[model samples]
Target chain A: MPVSTLTDPTLKDAHYLVDTGFEHGEMLTIVGKCEVDYDGRASSHLAPGERLVILKPDGTLLVHRNKQRKPVNWQPPGSTHSARLDDNRLIVESVRSSPHEELEITFQTVVQVSRLEVDDVSDLELEGSEEDLRQRILADPDILETGFNAMATERETSAGPIDIYGQDADGTPIAVELKRRRVGPDAVSQLNRYVEALERNRPSKSVRGILVAPSVTERAKQLLTSEGLEFVSLTPEQEDISQPIGFSEDADK
Target chain B: MPVSTLTDPTLKDAHYLVDTGFEHGEMLTIVGKCEVDYDGRASSHLAPGERLVILKPDGTLLVHRNKQRKPVNWQPPGSTHSARLDDNRLIVESVRSSPHEELEITFQTVVQVSRLEVDDVSDLELEGSEEDLRQRILADPDILETGFNAMATERETSAGPIDIYGQDADGTPIAVELKRRRVGPDAVSQLNRYVEALERNRPSKSVRGILVAPSVTERAKQLLTSEGLEFVSLTPEQEDISQPIGFSEDADK
Candidate 1:
């Protein structure tokens, strides 16, 4: 069966099904009124409420309330999960080590429980990331600045990897940092570190740092100015200006 | 009915149930073989695969595969959702404005669809936060420093809100920044901004800046030293040493 569901089952039945689901590596969903306690990097306690709890095969546990996108409490993947009937209540616990977090859910009433067989193996292809921004600049170096000669990307330095490393028309070394969205002083600091590393590698040479992003915060701008860095306004998405406004040769087709 | 489920429903039936689910403001879960497309701050496309799709009444959508804690793709709360039948496929669309993101799922085969009635209205009470750390310091100021007297918390500064504002034994004003976890240079920069702001506000008086966290990164330590700031090793959680090791009063009870 692709899915096995029980509505308003006895605690013993629910525990049996949950244990079977765990052993068979199935995704289980339990809707019930439960109080949750979490102890880890942080500790939290949720009062008794009816919520949806998902236990994934890979040891991901999510306790979601009705109102928000984020789980009220969650144990990340690689946690060990167990379910048992304690007294008359069904207790579910998920535990993970190395930082050590534990999530415990005690159910007052189980409204529904389901075990699902899921098979998924597809990768998401994404665009308009920092990588895409780098690609755009590499494809048209003039877009960054006229006479900007591209040299290397993800060039490693003592500090970290430079997003785009190159030289200008004057042959002065330049280190470029790319951000897909509006950034703050941290990005500026990152670029500064890379520039400092480059200068240290070649003490006689001066390296110019440029930050490429859609926009920058006021503090970031101030820091850039203090550090003698440059900012270029650009987005990761390719500009729509490539389409001609008027007549097209393929209009008849 | 608390939950209405359909297994291997026809495309038309799935569309009808989905439309009904939307109209009734119920949580809907759809498991199917589908391809997904997303466009917004970023864009993505997922090839056909079996996955679980969740739609919350508050207008949140989540696309989950079998693995990973995070949803493969999600539209946060407040995105409008709609389902329609196109040719022989069922297409569900979620869209939100102000940054304008859209997620589209085209299901080639609907395995199961469930509409659940959920009622949850409980807030999570959390501990081991920066606020908890602040409380711990306020309760026993000496943990921060000898003769340290806490004055205010969330004190307003031009840069932002200072976590804790206090005075040292010398009566010199101190601005303490709190972090629940280990931090990097960004935390140092934030503390620096607050200290600078405080100095500007009272030019003649010397102000001290201190960062309190479990630990600091190497670069952050260097930056703190350069700025002449101080770091104290502390965690948000109350120490377990409160219990006497050999003789516990609770042992008799």
Candidate 2:
């Protein structure tokens, strides 16, 4: 059976199914009224409420409430899962080492329990990231500046890796930082660090810093000005890319 | 009905259930083979694979593959959802404005569709947050330093709000930045901004900056030393707080 479900099962029966599911490495979901406790990097307690609990074979566990996309609590992949019954309650616990986190869910009533055999082997292809922005600038350096000469990418400095190292038309050294979306003062600080590192390395020469992003916050603009840096408005994805033909917008029907 | 389930549904049947589920404001889960496309702040395309799709009542959507804690793709709350049949396939689309993002899922075969009525009103009680750390310091200022006086919290500055604004025993103006966990160079820069703002406001007095967290990265420590700032190691939750009595460690049995 690809999916096995038990509705309103007795506590003993639910425990048996959960034990078997853990042993057989099947994905399991339990809908019930439960209270949760978490301890590790942080600590939390959830009062009794009905929730959907999902346990994946790869040791991922999620507790979902009705309203939000993010799970109320979760154990990342590679945790150890166990179940037990005590004081007329069913308890499920997940624990992980190396930073050491533990999440415990105690159920008062089991509305439903399901075990599923899932088969999925697909990867997600994404665009409009920092890498895409870098490619765009590299393919057409003139887009960044009219006389910019590209030298190297991810060039290392004592502070960190400079996103792009190049020279302007005037031949002064330039350190470029890339942000895919809008930026704030943090980006300015990052660029300042790289510029300072370059100046320290070559005491007699002047270095310029430029930040490339779709936009900058007012505070970031002020910080850039105070630090003697520059900003270039650019996005990771081109604006002119058209959507796929035949993609329907009539889904409401 | 609190719950409804359909197995091996035809595309037309699935579409009908999805439409009704959306209208009734129920949480729906669909298990099927599908392809996903997202266009928004970024763009992505996922190839055909068996996945679990969850649609929450408050305009949240999640597509989960078999293995990870994070959804393969998701739409945050406040996105309008709709479904339809196209070319014998079940299509679900979610769209949101104010940045204008869209997510589309095309299902080749739907194994099951379930609508669940979840009752969750209880809020999570969490500890070990930055707020808790602030409270801790407020309760006993000496934990931060002997004779250190706390003047205000969330004190507004041109840079941002200082987590804690105070003075040292020497009566020097102090700006304290707090982090719940280990921090990197960014935290140092943030503290620097607050200190600079204070210095600009009062030109005669030298302002001091302090960072408080459980720990600091080596790079952050270097940045702190170079910028003439201070760091204090402290956790949001005290280490001596004991676990509840009778909390079982024998859960493996």
Candidate 3:
């Protein structure tokens, strides 16, 4: 196993490309998307419907399905007066410009019930198990799963054999571990070992691993790049993975 | 009854002094007072220990009575979270801030039922006789007595007696006619006349009115303002005055 770390500023363009959208002021809609590329793309390779979002504007926010010509509905991020920003022009434009990816509607549930707090796995009245979680991942046609505990093998670490894992719609396996509490060279070594073990042992499907954390040490990011493992981090508002691409039309003005 | 209108914005401002809390980005807490001039002070104001709120932050909203500083103890607005903002905050910040008024806690039911379709409230529904409406208003302390609505009497141009009525809260009132269509400058003029009559009738009380319309004209805002009758062009959100406010703490970086 090897160890490495990296920081966002050192990366080309300061951040890796996760998605693209059409931004008119605070209103943003995913006009198009590039494949989740760890490396930055050249301007010549810019796809017709793809554009970067670099700001968060104040206005209406509407979410709708693919190729829809008008925003189905709207909600103000932080105010009363629900329909304050419902402009017809913006709704039409967003629908006209929306990309092909099916809008992923995250099922949000806040559990304040003490019996079902975050760490209550044993008490969890599960419909299934860890393997069931993976099976559910595989069963999804759209395959956008989030907030599930990762499955790791007994490849071992200073803490434990418990590592992070992800499964795609077709059962492609990708493992990820967080160095959330601390950042150092050893994180790279640790993630690399997990990746190597997963690859060599050959879990039930195609396997890859990602090292995800808030901010990676420079050395770790550099070495991971050299070793070809994915590295991911947050950029302010985008930290909420479930938030859709853009602001609503009313939000723009 | 002599008829005149309130054309001065300053008087309107004074009429709406207690309502500045509902203004943009401002907060209002109804610290109940037995008496005061409205710097939020009181000669005999006693704290009722309940707080209600209306907040608008950058990307977050808060419209709940956050009592005891714990999640479970929270209640939706109007019930625990009153329409007033200060009452909501007092339940949490009472330990530090001095009491300014004796706040009251009135309850209203707020249920979450989506896709509310706004249709016209029929003229029949909108057309209860003046006596019936006055009786209905007086019967519900939760209505007029909660300081949401205040009634004023004045002379009308076409109709002899007019009721100058404010909205549910301490907002601008309307020159309501039990049966009227094609609300014109006369309806406008009559509303102004009532405002004057009401002021003369009750020299101590502030007077305002809305001329209820099946549809208000494009020039209605200007016409109403010129005549000194504050009218509300009811939006769908305003119409759903009973909707409960919900709170969710989203983790943002």
Number of the predicted model whose TM-score against the real structure is largest: 2
By DockQ, the best candidate is 1
CAPRI category for model 2? medium
Worst 10 residues of 1 chain B by lDDT: B242-251
**Rank order (by TM-score, best first):** 2, 1, 3
Candidate 1 local lDDT, residue B78? 97
Q: Please give the TM-score that candidate 1 achieves against the real structure.
A: 0.92
Which stretch of 10 consecutive residues in model 3 chain B shows the poorest summed lDDT?
B109-118
lDDT tens digits, residue span B1-253, model 3? 1111111123223224323323332222121111111111211222222222222111111212211111111122222111332422212111102323222322121111011011111111122234444454445524333454545544343224665354446564434543223444435544554565456656776765655543466454555665566543321111245634443335332
Ranking under lDDT, best-scoring first? 2, 1, 3
lDDT of 2: 0.91
Clashing pairs in 1: none
What CAPRI class is candidate 3? incorrect
lDDT of 2 at B68: 89
DockQ (Cα-based) per candidate? 0.64, 0.60, 0.01
Residue by residue across B1-253, what tens digits does model 2's lDDT show?
A: 2777777889889888888899899888888889999999899999998888899999999998779899999999999999989998999999988889999999999887877888899999899899999999999999888888999999999888999999999999999999999999889999999999999899999999989999999988999998999998999987687878867869846
After superposition, the stretches of candidate 1 with alpha carbons farther than 4 Å from their true spots are: A196-206, A243-253, B171-173, B199-207, B243-253
Q: Each candidate's lDDT (Cα)?
A: 0.91, 0.91, 0.32
